[model samples]
Target: MRLRGVKGSRNIEDRRRSGGGRGRAAGGIGGVGLIVVLAIGLFTGVDVTSLLEGADAPQTQSGQVSAQDEQAAQFTSSVLATTEQVWTKIFNEQLDRQYNPPVLVLYSGVTQSPCGGASGATGPFYCPADKKAYLDTSFFTTMSRQLGASGDFAAAYVIAHEVAHHVQNELGILPKVDQARRASSQNEANALTVRLELMADCLSGVWARNVQGLLERGDLEEALNAARMIGDDHLQRQAGRVPNPHTFTHGTSAQRARWFDTGYETGNVGRCDTFAAARL
Candidate 1:
């Protein structure tokens, strides 16, 4: 969590001042559904609708960054740089290939992505089409105040998880998974989606391990708590509903925490394979 002297990333595209001035299609999504989708996507992965949407809208642009926004931007850039380093080493040492890092786009209220036009209402998501991770940093505040997750490490976990989706894209897992999902029943697709998200959670843990020396006390717990906070069962219950395993696109709380722990403990990508687990 000590990010004071670390160098941030130059790939960051800051559009906080620009506002993007774009809106979602009418009747697209509301605040309540947005919160639910966010809680789901934060760790559980998003529904296919949001993931596969190809609605591209024109973007209007300009402005200055505030002190608070500037600080958040710095922290985000630094965390992204750390992911780049860790994943690069991982790709070279484990996969015997070069790691191409994704752009981390930092936007304010709204922005246009190749996948779709989104605001903080849609939450942080990775557009595989563009190989970019889009974020509205205010989600950090929402995580603390509304979602019961906090701390710098928790925020880092969110970023790392999104970056993990990019990792999946790089590894060809995403395309295959998408193909399978397209051919699957609803329950089956949900199951596959859960495995996909759990894998991302595990990948984030692997990143945590590679950066372990930089972590301070309680950092691991912070990430674990975050994983717990966004489980599908927990979010459903929090929304005053009964927990249904069949509808879960993300694993339960215990599964999420355990998968993340598996990666953190082993620090081996090979061990983080959720697809072959047979019990995830």
Candidate 2:
């Protein structure tokens, strides 16, 4: 993706010094899990307990942010700006409304949110309570080294996907889904969660479609690779063979590809409805 001369979003809050500090009560989640939380929240409503948590405890204080910190800040803002432009046009044409952008918060290790306190290890997430997308820039490195996902576009995909959650929130899809999940059984909730996440992946594809003219040759592939790399199946394989489906949060590799392709190919949010689909 060519992001040269693009405007950085003004809707950003910098808090990079907060290390992925341990919270009073922490939940275990990985990069792939972060995607699931973000995705399902768009269509299945967010899981409050499942969403807030991290891996390690980093110190939260000054002197943690370096000069390079500002660069990451600017890059995140620029990527967010692109998503804003894409979604703005999408909201107007698709739903006949102006897209209300969400605030992007940059935090270090862990920080407090309207939803709860999250560690950097929890990855990037959006808090519907405060209408802000929280990110710890260090995760960009983690995306490549730990998640096996790379490229600036991959990072952009993460941001756009989270923004897609805000879109769902704005449309009231989140609250409705949240209510449904609360009334569901464990297995049922997981099923609904899968559908929701796939939809977010599809919605990310919608963003990609809107920016078709702006992407380079490998840009789409990079985003797809990100999806593939972070699938529940992929993470399971990384963990070990004998993967359990019951514990799977995000869909498998094939499902991820299919949903993402569905949105990008049609560029329509209506077609990205995962709940209505038989197979997620």
Candidate 3:
């Protein structure tokens, strides 16, 4: 992605140097399991409080911010501004409504959200309770180093996906889905969650479509690879477990990529109705 002249978002809440430090080591989730959870929570609006409960209390102080961290912050802010512009126009033209953008919270290791305590291990998530997306930019390092999903566009996809969740909230889809999930069986709830997540992936593609001028060659593949890498099936295999359909909260790798492609090709929000589709 070429973001040289893009304006940074003013709705950012930077807490990277706010004295908060990384939480204790993953207690029971273990390193690999933590990564799996992180993959699942990436770009997801689902509250992962229970999965993150094992982390010990956050430390009171943090190290000095490095130049690299500052650069990441600026990049994140630029991507967010693009999303704000894209979605605002999308809402006005497509939905005939005003788009209220969500605040993106940039934290380092750990931060407090209305939903719960968050750490780097929690990955990036949007808390519907607060209507804010929380991100520890270090996850971009984790994605490249461990998950093999690197590239500026891949990172932009992450931000767009979280913002997509906020879009779902703005459309009044989340609360109704949450209510249905509560009344569903475990398997059914997981299925619903998958639809919710896949829709976000597709919506992220919609954002990408609107920002075509900034994208470069191979950028789309970077995002698709990132989507494939974080699929529940892919993450399960990474964790040395057999892929189980019943346990999937996010759609399969193929489903994610296809849905994203759908939105990107059509640039139509109506085409992203994962819930109404008989086949994923």
Candidate 4:
């Protein structure tokens, strides 16, 4: 990873330390239900616009957070900046268009996103409604300790995946998908969600491919491992539950890895049309 002198992104909005308040689970749902709640936010990018509407979040109280965590914030911002550069150049050279910059929000506990009032539990999400990416840096620690998805690149992939949704939104795919999801059956809708999630994984791979110099020998593997670790199947199994196809959202581990590999190998946005596949 030759990122020695690369410019970090200035699009970061840090709201760590003091947070507005805790987010309450709507109905005190069970594990599977809670997983769905978290998974939706994780997969399609958080709906900041819908989520933040009417949710009251007070100003954060003043308290010094860890300097180490602050460094992580800067690192996340740098990866974001690199993604912006990669996407912009790719769009201009390949598609004859310019990519608009999306704001990245970093918060602790709870913060307001264009989608809605964001809680740390929402994970990292990109709200199409507001076009901003929301994240809580503490998830990095959780990723390493609980999720087995460690490393800066693993963390960076999380952000990049959300950014990929932003790209999808720019392509006008999101609205169509949203409409289709609403009209489709629950099973069919989950299938579409799997495609959407896989495509985002592919988009992250596209970002990684363009930033070749920024990746090391095991970096890609770490990211791939992270991807596999977080698949719905893996998450469900880890929770000691049977894998149910009807409830699956992010697709299987192999499917996720394959799509991600697809993007990395092709590095072309057109090749990432997961929606057109006969099978994912």
Model 4 ranges with Cα > 4 A deviation: 21-62
* Candidate 2: Cα lDDT at 131: 77
- Put the candidates in TM-score order, highest first: 3, 1, 4, 2
- Name the candidate that leads on lDDT: 3
Model 1, range 126-245, lDDT digits (tens) per residue?
777788888878677766766778899999999998888888889988778877877999888888888888998899999999998789999999999988988888766766668888
**Models ranked on lDDT:** 3, 1, 4, 2
Q: Which is superior by TM-score, 1 or 2?
A: 1
Q: Local error of candidate 3 at 77, Å?
A: 0.2
Task: Report the C-alpha lDDT of model 2 over 179-261, residue by residue, as the tens digit.
Answer: 77679887776777777778888998999888877788788888888888777766666655455566565687788878888
Per-residue alpha-carbon lDDT of model 4 for 1-280, expressed as tens digits? 4566888898877767653445552432122211232232233322323323343232234445567667778888888899899999988988898899788887766676545565555677777766777777767776776667878788878888888888888888777787787799988988887888888899889999999888887889887988897777776666666777787778788888888899999999888989898878
> How many clashes show up in model 4?
16
Best by TM-score: 3
How well does candidate 4 score on lDDT at residue 220? 91
C-alpha positional error of residue 143 in candidate 4 after TM-score superposition, expressed in Å: 0.8
* Steric overlap count per candidate: 0, 8, 0, 16
lDDT of 3 by residue, 104-136 (tens): 999877677656666676678787777888888
> Candidate 2: where are CA atoms >4 Å away?
17-36, 39-61
Candidate 2, which ten residues in sequence have the lowest lDDT sum? Answer: 40-49
Lowest-sum lDDT 10-residue window in model 3: 28-37
Q: Model 4 compared with the native: what TM-score?
A: 0.86
